[model samples]
Each structure stands twice: as structure tokens, then as C-alpha cells.
Target: MNSIFLKAVRNIKTLQYFPTNVVRACGATKSLHTTNVRNDLMEFFDIKKNWNETNIRVGRAWKLDELRIKSNTDLHKLWYVLLKERNMLLTMEQECYEKMNLFPNPERIDKVKESMDNIEKVIRERNIAYYQLETGETGERPVEDVVNLVGLQEKYEKKEYHIPRFMNTRWVQSYLDHGLFNSMAIKKFYRLYREKQHNEERKARNRDMNHVIQLIKRFPDMDMEKLKAEYPNVDIEKAKRSRKSRGHYVPKY
Candidate 1:
């Protein structure tokens, strides 16, 4: 008898809480922060008005400068809100693809990502500041230049080791007898790699010189001061000396 009474009360409460129109509205979604039913699965869908709309215009993303002004507590709250918004947008995108519908305002996802990135940047800046104030070092992991087996430079994060290099025979052996970088082939590869890098630099320098000569031929009375400032690496005098820089009209230089 008690169970029957409890069931009847629950049915009445459901009807009173969710009317026919309100229940139908639950099928559509808006911001969970604005809605009373945050845990509802239907929150993944777009609002009823936007469901059939061709355009869903939104503003620009949060800039790093704007985010930096916000407090940490506000940032933490906003992070979760953006996370929920991303979840809803992803769900709607997938649904649209499955149903062969045009996804509206797809760039909103990028804006949300940009905002989240700014938040992370602000947090990282705060952490770095706090750590530098307390200790003389940044809290970020220490990274240093290291050479790989291919003799290429790489940024390697330092790891904590329980033992020293001398005590760790296996670690020492990895860099000595068994290391691929210690081979004659690796040395040859490094030499070839260096030659390729130098060749690229030389080509770039020649291109800059040729471009400057062409500029001198084309625009004889162009701003010499501005040109010098633009290409500090290229000597304008050498370009003016070039025969290619000679045009129908003589250069001002």
C-alpha cells in the first residue's frame, strides 16, 4: 500500500514538474548554465530556433590580453563552460553529418578552441610568475638541446634518475659502444646534412641579392632608406654595382 502511494506521488510530481510543452522543449538544447536541467542528455542538440536556421553568427574569440585580466577563479569556471559548449558543438556536428545536413557556424568550434588556448596561456603565465617569485626557476619542465642517433638537434626534457651515469652501466653503454651516433656512417650523414643546410643559406642569400638588383632596375627613385631597412643583410651598394641593376633610367643611388 505504501509503495503504491509513493508511485502515485512520483507520477503527480513528474506531471507537475514537466508539462507537455516543457517536455517537448527538452528535445532542443541551449546553454546548460541557463537551463534548469543540466544533466539532461538532450543538452547535446541545438536550440529549436537555431535547428532550422541557415546562419548562426557569433563574435570573435577571447584574446590572450583579455584573458590575462580575468581572475583565476573566473578562468576555471569559464574553462568548464567552454568544455561543455565544445561537447555540444561536436555532438551536433556529428549528428548533422550523419543526417546529411549543412553544419551551421562551424567556425564556432575554432573560436571555442582559441578561447580555451588563451585560458591555458594565462594559467601557464601565472604559474611561471608564481614559481619565479617563490623559487628562482620557472615551474615548467627543463628542456635542453640533445643530439639524436641521426645527429639531428632536438629539445629533450630532462628526466629524474635515481642513479648517476657511472653507477648506471646500462645508460652509459647506450651512449658508448652500442650508440648508433658513434658510428662512421652517422658522421658522414652529419657532414652531408651540414652541406645541405649551408647550400640552402647560400641560395637564399643569392636570391636576396638578385631581388634587390631587380628592385633597383624597376623602381629607380624608390625609398633607399626603407629598402636598406627592409633588407639589412643585403648590401644595396653591391646591388647598385651589379650590371643587372642598370635599366633604361639611371638609379638615384
Candidate 2:
């Protein structure tokens, strides 16, 4: 009977220990889960203390080199964090502006924008590198030089071709016949363009010469070196030969 009683006691003790172990595990798991949730929430936004502050102090932006070393998942999470922070700052700024109050530290917006740009640049660099490694080509849209109707060369981005270049009749006819458009009008346009450019240059030269002549007339003892330094484009020797440059005083010789 004592043996059976002892066996019952042992079984009861075992059962009690099992529940204690389960309870401890459940408590630990709960604590860990709460911690993880708190961290996630904290990381997604700024600290709670900064919520109502007029001027929130922040450090410099994340450098491209620093971000490049981080893993892709880390970068992705950081982007969303920055994006939310930017939106919040913008909202606060707009509110302050509406209230006719000064928005402290306006440079913060510029810093955040710069950081976002750097992040995108780094991502593009990585993408290009990966593409080059895999496909032996830079994965970007191709650009080409083409002449426009105005007879000026311009850059045009090439697109995918379904029809071959020679098969397009409209494109071929446009470039083949220059006489289809009035050749006289083109010549007249070119002549006017050249005349406008020449007039501007002539006016600039005359203005410089007149200014130099006035300077000489006003300051008879002015330093020639200073005049040359001030107007590098004006030829001092040619100015000396001008009738306006001759002083009214008679020659002593």
C-alpha cells in the first residue's frame, strides 16, 4: 500500500512539473512576441517623444556607400521608414505653414530628398551591374542622334521595332525630298538666324569700346593694366588708336 501511495505521489509531482514548464514557456514566448511587435512599430516611425516638438533634431542622411553595404531587405525596409518620415515631416510643415508659424529646420526636407535620391542611384547601380553580369549589356533605353524638321540635330530615344526601317514608306519619303518643303523659307530662316547672332556680337563689341573710352576720358591717369584686367575682351591697343581715345591736350613735343 505504501509503494502504491509513493507511486501516486511521484505521478502527481511529474504532472505538476510539466504544467510549470509549459507556463514558463508560454510566458517567455508572450514576452518575446510583445518585444518584437514594439520594435517593429518603433522602427516604422520616429520616437514618441518627438511627436509634438516644434523642432526635431535629426542626424545627416544615410550615405550611398553606407547603404550599398546593407542587404536588400534592410534597404527595402529603410526606404519605407524614410518615406513615412518624409510624409510626416511634410504634413507637419504644411500644418505649421497654415497656422502662420515658422517651420523649424526647413533643410530637413532637402536632406530627406537627397537621401532618397542617393538610395535610388545606388539601386540603379546595382541593377545595372547585375544586368551586365547576366546579359552582357547595360539594361537601359537606347538613344540615337536624329535630325529634326527644323534642320537641327537632336537626340531621340529608340524604341522596339516591329516593322523594319526600310519597310516604312512615310519615314523614307520625309527625308528623301528636301524640295517638297520650300527651300527659300529654309534659306531665309538660316539668314535671319545668322544676322541675329552677328548683331548681338557687334552690339557687345561696341558697348565694350564705348565703356572703355568713357573710362579713359573720366580717369586720365587710370592704370592701363587695370583696364585690361577689367575688360579682357576689349583690345587696349585698338582702343588707343580710336579718335575718341585722343585727349584734348596738345602734344608737348
Candidate 3:
């Protein structure tokens, strides 16, 4: 009977210790699992084993037509893959620079970027088609043709506002009531701009005319059709009559 009591006491102690050990084991397992997951995630930024080698070959960028054939879910997943690839390439490049080593195959970065851009374009096309089918709209940013403060036409993207347009005193005054775009200073600037543009055009014409004259003086038997095509803006016939077009030698005309 005494042995039985001692055995019961030992069993009770075992139960107490067992829970503590189990708890510790569970905590260790949880920590190990977390660490494994973290390592897997870090794989996104890792480069290949042969990255440090001299020559690294890679494939071409994802074409738009190829991406278009993929399902939306597949495309979405591919975008993340490309994004990870770009990050990895950038990381590898930075590391190589830090170590004063050559980065292998810089075009890989371009390929990944191109693929990402194509994926986005495909997604956008799908979005537009879906929106048009359901809502009769492209579901893109709404734009309106507007004249800017500089009197130039621009497509103004519509944005959300808290207050009504009429209630916005500062905006109304700047763009409408007391707009500086229509001021006398702007008119003066525009006049000067126009004069500068005219001067440039005049100078360009004179330069081309001079070139045509020089060519004729040098190459008397030059292809007239080719010369005319080369100097479309310059009056070739008028240039031929110029004194500069005549060579130092006696005219063969």
C-alpha cells in the first residue's frame, strides 16, 4: 500500500513536468515554423547561385499577346512573380556594386520590367472590356478638355472634391474671376514667344538654302531628284540661280 501511494505521487509529478516540457516543445516548434516561413519569404530577394559568374543568360520579356491569353488569376500571380524577380535583380545589382564586382546580365532587369508592364497592360485591357460590358464605360479616369492657365489645351482629369465648385472661392478666383492667364503680362509673353519661334524658323530656312547652294556648287552632276528630296523646304531652283551655287571653274551650262 505504501509503494502504491509513492507511485501515485510520482505520477502526479510526472503529469506536472510533462505539461511544462510539452509547452516548451510547442513553443520551439512554433518558433521553428516561423523561421522556416521567413526563410521562404526571403527567397524572393535572393539571387541565383550562378549570379556571381561572368555570363548569365535569361529569356525574353513576356509579350502582350502571351499575357492576354492568360486568365486573370494567372496574370495576377505572374505580376507578383515578376515583381519579386525585379526586386531580386535590384538586390543582386546593389550587392555587386557594394562588393565592386560586375553585375551579370543587366538586361535581366529590363526583361522583368517589360514583363510587368505587359502584365499591367493586359489587366487594364481586361478591366476596360469588363467595365464596358457591365457599365457602358471604360472605368478609367474621366478627362475633360480644358484650357490651362497658359492658354494651352490640356486633358484635365476629374478628381473628387469636398465642396461644390462655386463654393471654392480660391480656385474660382485663380482660374476664373481674377485669372492671371488673361492678364496683360501673359499677352506680352505670348507675343515674345511667337517672335522667337518665327526667328528660329527663318534661321533654319536660311541655313538649309545655304547648304543647298554649297551642294550644287560642289556636285554639279549631283542627282537633282535626291537633292530636292534632301532639301524639301529649300527652293532648289531658286538656289541654283544664286551666285554662291556657281563653281570657280567655267560653267558647263
Q: Model 2, range 1-253, lDDT digits (tens) per residue?
A: 9999999888778758786555464576455433244534345444568655678677898899998998889889888877987976787677677888777777888888888888898888989999999999889788999867655568998887888877877876776655524567766876797899899999999999988987776666779899999999998777776778767764121
Where's the lowest-lDDT run of ten residues in candidate 2? 33-42
**What's the CA error at residue 217 for candidate 3, in Å?**
10
Off by over 4 Å in 2: 1-54, 145-156, 159-253
Model 2 lDDT on a 0 to 1 scale: 0.77
Count of steric clashes across candidates, in order: 0, 0, 0
In model 3, which runs have C-alpha deviations exceeding 4 angstroms? Answer: 1-48, 97-101, 184-253
TM-score of 2: 0.49
State each model's C-alpha RMSD to the native: 7.9, 9.8, 10.8
> Model 3, 1-253: lDDT tens per residue?
9999999888778758786555464577455433234456556555457765888877899999898889988998888878878888898888889989998888999999989988888888989999999999999999999877766668999988999889999889988897678898777877887899899999999999999999999999889899999889989888888899999887655
Score candidate 3 by TM-score against the native. 0.60
- Candidate 2 positional error at 212, Å: 18
